[model samples]
Target chain A: AQTVTQSQPEMSVQEAETVTLSCTYDTSESDYYLFWYKQPPSRQMILVIRQEAYKQQNATENRFSVNFQKAAKSFSLKISDSQLGDAAMYFCAYRSPLRDDKIIFGKGTRLHILP
Target chain B: GAGVSQSPSNKVTEKGKDVELRCDPISGHTALYWYRQRLGQGLEFLIYFQGNSAPDKSGLPSDRFSAERTGESVSTLTIQRTQQEDSAVYLCASSSSQGSANSPLHFGNGTRLTVT
Candidate 1:
């Protein structure tokens, strides 16, 4: 069984600053994927970024990037130059490379942007 | 639909009643997924459909919950004899292909279900 863990329950960052949300997971499979999703008040889950387990290089999407440490099974998201729109619930997810693509999610960290 | 569309953005049902939530995935998408999000909680995987493969119901919390997908298009999740604990937001998502390390799910605005 694969399980994702988000240690931070809530986080806040000043506008134009940076913040990092920590995430860790436990999985037996060597091939898999890690993801960060943001859910606004509208209730739509938006893909923030993704990292492939095999890729040693971390994933980056504009202001959103991930520190993917495969050996330690830690995948943390870094948000640089935060904006008010960044206020949302951020979730870290895990997906297996095998047949069943069910995503295992961690309890999200609510991010608040202090203007 | 242009994106994943879930019907009945909000549903209120009584305990012991049955409810059905619908999800219309994007055209040509081969994968569909159902997830539950309780208040102040993470998204819980409920079921998954990939092409013609047998659906994965491993995440379903109980047998009272069942889901069906017609071909590779629309899907419906049914909860029979719903309980208060079943109250949560039902989210639907779709991907261009089967679950892989590369495919990312596109989610729809979930349906908020309230069982009283």
Candidate 2:
């Protein structure tokens, strides 16, 4: 079975600063996909970024980027010049077509932006 | 409509009662997913359907939970003899294709189910 883990239950960062959220997963397949999702108070999940296992380069979208270390099975999210809107619950997810059947998600990390 | 739609934005039911939640995926999306989120928690994948492939119910917590999708359109999740623990936000999402590129998921606002 494939499972994702987000060690940090909650995180705080000052506005205009940078913060990194850690994520690790256990999967036997080599070809897969990873994603980071942001869930606001509205309970709407917005995709932040995604990385493919076959690609060595990490994925970046605007202020959000991922540090994907396939060997370590670690995929972390980095937010640069964070804003108040970035404060939300972030979830890490894993998916594969050849291995597991459904997308697996971590417990999620609640991000708090401090002024 | 333009995005994934989940009906009955909020549903409150008594324990041991059966409840049904509906999901309408994007018009041309080939994949649909159902997830359950408890308070302050992450998504718990419940079921997945892709085109004409057999649905994956491995993530379902128990036999009491079941879901069905007609082709690539609407889907409904049914919980029989629901328990208090079943109270949570049920989210539905869909994607045209499950890939790493620009194919990201489109999610619905979710249905808040409260079993009292």
Candidate 3:
């Protein structure tokens, strides 16, 4: 079984500043996919960024990026130049490389942005 | 993308009653999934369907919870004898394909279910 853990229950960042959300997972599978999802007040789950275990290079999507350390089993999300709209519940999820494998998610971290 | 859509945005039912939640996957999507999110928490995987094949129900908390998919299009999660603990937001998501390492899931607004 794979388990994802987000040590921080809540986080806050000043507008235009950067914030990093930590995430760690325990998985025996060598091949897998990692993802970060954001759920706003509207409650719609939106994809933030994703990382492939096999890729040594980190994944970056504009202001959003991931620091994936496969050996350490760590995948953390970094939000650069944070804005008020970035305030939401962020979750780290894992999906097995195997076909039909279900996605497992960690307890989310509530983000707050200060103006 | 059309994105995944769910019906009955909100549902309230009494204990011991059976409730069904619907999920409509995006056109041409081959994978659908059901998840449960308790208030102020992360998502809990409930079930996964690949086309018309057998679904993976490993995440269902109990036998009272079951789901079905029709021709890889619409899927429904049925919970029998609903309990107070069952009250949560039921989310639906779909992906272009399953068993792939790179596919990212697209989620719907979710159905808020309350069991009284």
Candidate 4:
């Protein structure tokens, strides 16, 4: 069984500043994928970024990027130049690289961007 | 539909009653999944169907909850004799990853199920 943990329940960032949401997971498999999803007030789950365990080079999607440390079993999301619209509930998810692919999501972190 | 669309955007049902939630996955998508999100909680995996085969049904909380997909298209999640604990948003997702397992899931807005 794979378990994803997001230690921070809530975090706040000033406008134009950066925020990093931390996530860790426990999995015995050697190959897997990590992801960050955002859910806004509308309650639509949107994919933020993704990182494959085999890729040491972190994944970056404009303002959203991930710091994936496979050895440490940690995958963190960094949002740069945060804006008010960036405020949402962020979730870290884990997916197996095998045939039966299932995604496991963490408890989630509520991010608040202050103007 | 253009994206994964779930019907009955909001369902208010009494405890012990049965409810059926529907999901229409995107065209050409071979994978469909059901997830539950309780208030103030993360998404919980319920069931998964890939190209007419459901290889994983382990995430379902209890036997009362079951789901089915036909011909790799529409899916329905049925909860029999629903309980208060079953109140939550039922989310449906679709992906193109059939057996190879690399595509990411695209989620719908979700059906909010309120069991009182």
What pairs collide in candidate 2?
none
| Top of the candidates by DockQ | 3
Model 3: residue B94 alpha-carbon error in angstroms: 0.7
TM-score of chain A of 4: 0.96
The whole-model C-alpha lDDT of candidate 1 against the native structure comes to: 0.91
> After aligning candidate 4 to the native by TM-score, how far in Å is the CA of A40 from where it should be?
0.8
Which prediction has more favorable DockQ, 1 or 3? 3
Q: Using DockQ, rank the candidates from best to worst.
A: 3, 1, 4, 2
True lDDT of residue A110, candidate 2:
97
What is candidate 3's lDDT per residue for B63-90, written digit by digit as tens? 9998899887998999999999999999
**Whole-model lDDT, model 4:** 0.90
Error of 3 at A67 (Å): 1.1
In model 3, what is the error at residue A36, expressed in angstroms? 0.7
Q: Of 1 and 4, which scores higher on DockQ?
A: 1
lDDT of 1 by residue, A1-100 (tens): 8899999999999999999999999999998988999999999999999999999999999999999999899999999999999999999999887755
> Which regions of candidate 4 fall more than 4 Å away from where they truly are?
none
Worst 10 residues of 4 chain B by lDDT: B96-105
Model 1 alpha-carbon drift over 4 Å, by segment: none
lDDT of 4 at A81: 95
Give model 4's docking category: medium
lDDT of 4 at B73: 94
Clashing pairs in 4: none
Encode model 4's per-residue lDDT on B11-116: one tens digit a residue.
9999999999999999999888898999989988888887888887888999998888898899999999999999999999998865345577889999999999
Clash number for each model: 0, 0, 1, 0
Native contacts, share recovered per candidate: 0.83, 0.59, 0.85, 0.57
